[model samples]
Target chain A: MRPLELRRIPLFATMTPADLAAVATVVEPVNYQRGTVLFGVGDPCAGISVVLDGIVRLFRRTPERREVTTGIVRAGGLMALCALCGEATHRDSAEALNHVHTVEIPTAALHVLGQRCPHLQEQAMRGLLERLDAVNAAFVIAQEQIPVQLLYLLRSVARLDQAAQRHPGDTMHPLALRLSHAELARLVGTDRATVTRALRLLEEQRLIQRKRGHVTGVVLSTPDRKVPV
Target chain B: MSDGGNRKVWYLRHIDLFASMTDEEVEEIAHLLDDHHIPPGVALLDHRDHDRVYLIKEGAVRLHTGGPEHQVTLALLPPGRMFGLSSTVGDADRTINATTLLPSYICFATWPKMAEVFARYPEVMFQLTRSLAEQVFRTETWLARLGMISPTARLADLLVELSDEFGEPSETGRRIRFRLTQADLARMIGVSRETVSRTMVELGRAGWVARESGRLVVRDRDALKMQANS
Candidate 1:
């Protein structure tokens, strides 16, 4: 909406005032409510969007048409940057986790402006590199055995919530998140029955305790183990 | 092209980051690349922006995590692909080890040197971005395939991907550049070695996969892809 607002985004933070203003002029503010699909796989990458508020989920469908959550982004995060900058089409679909606000910079304008601004193009390259590295880690967590898999996934989500820092010195982390078995299955790419089985196993080992059907907390048996990422 | 200098130019051109550059520009930049040969099974130390970016010029490298007792192969780096940026993954604060899968030739340049070239030929940023983005999509696709319901399906998915990424046309079918041991296949798919041996035997009987000059050849890629989805 405003050039100052655009400058607040780190991607534009290093740009000269002239370059920032040129980019700010192209950003179109868009908003969505919870449960709305923002974009689907194969959609032309319209442009890079910077999240102004709320959370968004990025996922890809399995061959069986099951949704497997890949990454989560909150306010102050950038979306579609890698696809818009690197690829022609969006590789994954995005959905609003809640009421969300995002501003998208039109591709044509960004391209025209990028030719004159090295900073914009450099930031996009750096962002793509970071995204690639982050997804690489997620793939590692996904391959861990089921019970350990769920624990890692929770910790991952908590990292987004900044909840992990709440117990910085403690072994146990209270997730305080309520998710249905089906949702849990989607996150881990397993069936609800398998999720139930894994949850039971985690409970028996005293690694996790559920409260009122919500995952209350988790305990890593060896918190100081050489983290294999 | 037989000379090291000319061969290096050819290899550098194959990399997407340098694909769109003029021959003269490529020749100029090729001189900036430092080359080295590594024996199979040797590990690469972590490389950062200052240390330099390395690309596989010949042979393959394996990226894996976990201790030696339980190593899981995450990816097999094909020629023209870069290495080292994957040194860290998220907040794990740990390093992913890369070991040479075969005797290899690697070419590298520090970020500062690469940036100088990028400044000189602005178009390279686009190519580099596309290269990085495609890598992200491939990694994501590999992640999804690992979630398939059956070990057979998982193995099929892996085979189809291997042929797509690192295989070449052969008399029998698509011959994978790397000779993967059944043990290597097992470690990659996170299944037991015996399971990989049995699955390979089955695929061989089905006429979908075969061995050629010690490399894997995918004879029926369409059928293999179908099985991967099934």
Candidate 2:
């Protein structure tokens, strides 16, 4: 394996060739087919994993047996940094949303890597802090009424996806692509019927265009209007 | 230690929120208490205003408000949870007025000191944020379950939650030693007291549950599980 390619990952992007080689020594590369279960709740997490390619969805099954998708881990982002410190248990399960490639580094190797590379240490610490902050923020936002929560989340994920564009007459940046009704509903914490009604309301105001797989564009429309459920 | 001092420590120990805090942190926080004791019937955190946040160290505190005809209990914060977070978040005022149910020893934390501690520890900040968020979600979830779900379904969901939190293994079933009064059940599920009474009676008759003096003996866990599924 060409260890030089390891430098392409965001976490190791700043490290030198020598540093990457040191990391490549302990990193075990693994690939999975779509729909694979990487781990489940209560399984011992030996260390952190970084997505080299493909998407992984992390979700928890509530006591009522409802499956709540907490987050999706995309390529270039690190997953499970808290496992390194052994502070959090595997409260959620990780499943491959698509055929995926990841590098699994044992906790011992991560500590040694951190000790060897100050850059990795700082990156890991900052990443963990930011992830915790995001999770806390998500918890707060999710508690709102489903419609309010969905609109807020759509704008957020749109911005995160880099499709956000400021419209002259509105406060929120309109997302350039239309999120499929089902995908939009899942993110918004509601059923498709509610999401469909919400989108239609927005469409009537010309705030957004609804198309297959994407919205044509977001436009300045009106003030924040509550979707009548 | 003085009688008052030892009682204060004993009270703080029972609060789950304080369990993770260090002794030094507790000692530092205790300095804010001022050895103040309020007699029963006094309002600690009045409805609709910013004031001191209190941690009960001795005696019971009933979080309630409204006039004689409209009064309701929000919570009976025994000794762990801090009350008056509305003030911290800039709520116009406390939504529920806390009254001394019995003579109580309470510790007060001024806003500045609270901010200082939050700034000093990221872990504390994370925990506090998550805890506050969870409290809001829990309250909302309870309200939604009561409003949108059937009483039997709500009771089933409550059983599932309690089983996860405090169930004990038994020969017949996983017994839940829940010590909630009928009034507490009404407040928790956001239903009328009478509805809670009727629901409990029906559940008992259905053989899904058996009620003792103040606890629920879940006899048919599988049946309740089916109800939750349905």
Candidate 3:
């Protein structure tokens, strides 16, 4: 990537032109197909991958082979910076939730660049702090009712609609969520039957609306006008 | 430096973040820390207090969230671990309240001081990043356990984990030195106190765990490990 392109990232916004050029020399971009395992638990940490596009889900599998979704890394997010310390292995598995484009920074290169540029080090620290926020949020939601938990999950994974961005006067911001009921159940740590019931309740409350013929996806809108569901 | 300052520097060197640093660097970081002696039942870092990190030098601290009537214990941080990391990075607010479980000795550093140290030693920044990431991974695992597993399994897993983190070898098996109540265990596992009570009774009857003077002693390590994975 060009230094100009690297400068576009908020994490690199504070980097000087020369620093960006130094970073651009070492960073490599890679693409991952959907469902591809980026790295697995116990795998050696090659470096850090920063999401340039699409989504990556970090998760772990239980002894029974049940996959538990931990958190999703969206655009401009950093992955596995935690393994850059003295540790040699990844703590959990990261898979491509969709087609993902990421800039891979080798561990040695990151160390060199961080020493040369304090801005990058601060940004990396801030990124981990943001991730901690997400983990804490998930822990809090785990104690809520199934429906509330489902709603929280949807809100977390939903993508903002372009239309809402174009119209500043619009009161509602539409968000698109693409996940099957089973997937939603897995994310919420509940069964499909319970998910179905919860989705129905959310729909009745006008908090979520399913797209026609898209059984696996739904759209949620901000409450523009309050009407009793 | 006084004897107390030397002792504080000694404790600082044991922390993972400072363990690899040169003695001079550790001393520099130690000088930035303000000593605090907090009694039990006092909030060391309350919810919403930002821009400070506390390194526990001695005693236990409980990190918890929610109001008193419906609070949850996030983790019991032991000596040598740091808390309030969220405040050092940016505007992110602390989600949990950290309270001393026993009379404790703590060392604190403001965000500016920590940032200065990171700028001086970038490797420390990387180490801190990795530490926070480990914290995230652990929290995610706990959430998964709370959401998917049975209460018995959850309790079993908690015991096994705590023993590994804070245990000292004993004649029977391993003893968790921390004094954790059934209510605190319930909060950690996101279960009811009654559930913890019943599960403890079952484990006690099966000779897996025993209570000695309000502290838990893991008597049968193999059985508890099996229950944890079961």
Rank order by lDDT, top first? 3, 1, 2
Model 1 chain A worst lDDT window (10 residues) = A220-229
Off by over 4 Å in 3: A159-172, A213-229, B46-49, B87-95
Against the native chain B, each candidate's TM-score is: 0.86, 0.62, 0.89
Q: Give the runs in model 2 whose Cα sits over 4 Å from its true position.
A: A1-39, A46-58, A62-66, A70-88, A94-149, A159-172, A176-178, A188-198, A216-224, B13-29, B32-106, B111-154, B160-202, B207-230
How far is A34's C-alpha from truth in model 3 (Å)? 3.0
Interface RMSD for model 3 amounts to 3.2
lDDT of 3 at A60: 80
Q: iRMSD (Å) of candidate 1?
A: 2.2
Best by DockQ: 1
Each model's fnat?
0.49, 0.00, 0.49
State TM-scores per candidate.
Answer: 0.86, 0.53, 0.89
True-contact fraction in model 2 equals 0.00
lDDT to native, each model: 0.75, 0.59, 0.76
Q: How accurate is candidate 2 locally (lDDT)?
A: 0.59
* Cα lDDT of model 2 by residue, B1-230, tens digit: 67866666666656554567777665655554555688877887744445456666666676654444445444455544466655211111214567775677877876566656554533444344334434433333443343334666767776766555446666545665435566655655545679878988887888877665546677787888778657
Model 2 — TM-score against the truth? Answer: 0.53
Backbone clash pairs for candidate 2 read A177-A215, A178-A214, A178-A215, B15-B80, B49-B93, B49-B94
